[model samples]
Target: MALMTTDTRYTKVAIALHWAIAALILCNLALGFFMEGFEQPLRGFVIQTHISSGITVLLLSIVRIVWRLTHRPPPFAPGTRGWEKGLAHLVHFLLYVAMVLMPLSGWALISANPPPPPPGQIEAAPAPVPGGAAPAAAAPKARRGGPTKLWWVIPWPKIGPIQRMGTTPQGIAEQKLLHDTLVERHMQIAWIIIALLVLHVGGALKHQFVDGQAEFARMGIGRGRRAPR
Candidate 1:
């Protein structure tokens, strides 16, 4: 009987992107939760570095995803456990979801409740008013493709409680309620994503240190060379 082998190690591109993004997300998560929400003496330097690194990770992730569409990754070993394969897929999918959602949520959360404005500058609406449609006779504008549209979601304004008008008390309350609800939900999702990420890191460590496997190297520096079937 022959022992089975496989080209299971992740590709160099995938490994590099995976580790890079993972490190960025982990740092950002800590900065977001520990410093800001935790009420620590807000260090401007930490947050600036976090934001800059996160943007780099996101850009690289996009390129990696595009590369993946073009170049297929190696397959796992035949003897590999099913649960692990499933978990691996789940981890990756969750990562992508969290990566995209966290930033968007951050943006939305910031828009809803931003830092104090410069003295004199008036805080305005929750979101921007949508541009009015052109005359009926005018041709519709060309639709831009991909996640670009997702980011450009109807421009919302950045306003605060100061802008609330006494005349529209009911409307104001409703909008406030909606904004609070969204902000709360976004935060909850972020926490859940963070928990999952902790688990993910733990699992990788377990595979690397406890099991004495080469998983981390395969993902981090792309060292492992999976054998041809």
Candidate 2:
């Protein structure tokens, strides 16, 4: 419905995307770290499911950004001084950039990977990656965060590259190294993004509960117009 702020507040869509993405990203971060612990993992099963989920999230995020560009959001409360406003904008900008980049990097990293089916792991006929993924039960809303959370996955554009490698270990090492580097970059950016999100969300909550302001509402419901005093 209404997307613009009439009285300096967030619209419903913006609020929903903000919180939903935040939760998703946070979960992804936790999972990415957890995945690292699994020394060797299997595919065509649980891992496949997980990767598929990631790709879905990534597509939605891209959609969210396009939505953001088309729609104008509500503003911070009047009491939001210069520094607070600046910080909020900065945090949001960084978040958006990281969100997009995280997945793209993963996709590229996946692309760079040299595909040699792992030892003892048998290769199955390649699945068609509509957008660089398997033709699956459901599209990947998979977030790549467990290890990378570029969470920008519908599982993502990784498997196709592997398919191209065609079980050749010839170029696999270089691809693996490239993939590792992309993964590392994804992790580093994620930490920064997480910290910023924490600060942003924490500050918003503080303003809402402690400072007794309607900052959160600005992003939750469409901004309400006020009567002249």
TM-score of every model versus the real structure = 0.59, 0.67
Cα distance off (Å), candidate 1, residue 191: 2.4
Cα lDDT tens digits for candidate 2, 105-176: 655655653344457975433335334332333212231212323333322334565435534333333344
Clashing pairs in 1: 124-159, 127-156, 127-157, 128-156, 128-157
Supply the TM-score for candidate 2: 0.67
Instruction: List model 1 lDDT by residue over 1-229, tens digit each.
Output: 1122235565556766777877777777677666665333345456545545655665777877776677665565355578977987898677777776666555443343233335796533232213522212211121101121222343333334422321132333334444456668767867878778777878777776776667665554445654454
- The global C-alpha lDDT for each of the candidates, from Candidate 1 onward, is 0.54, 0.59
10 residues in a row with least lDDT, candidate 1: 138-147
lDDT of 2: 0.59
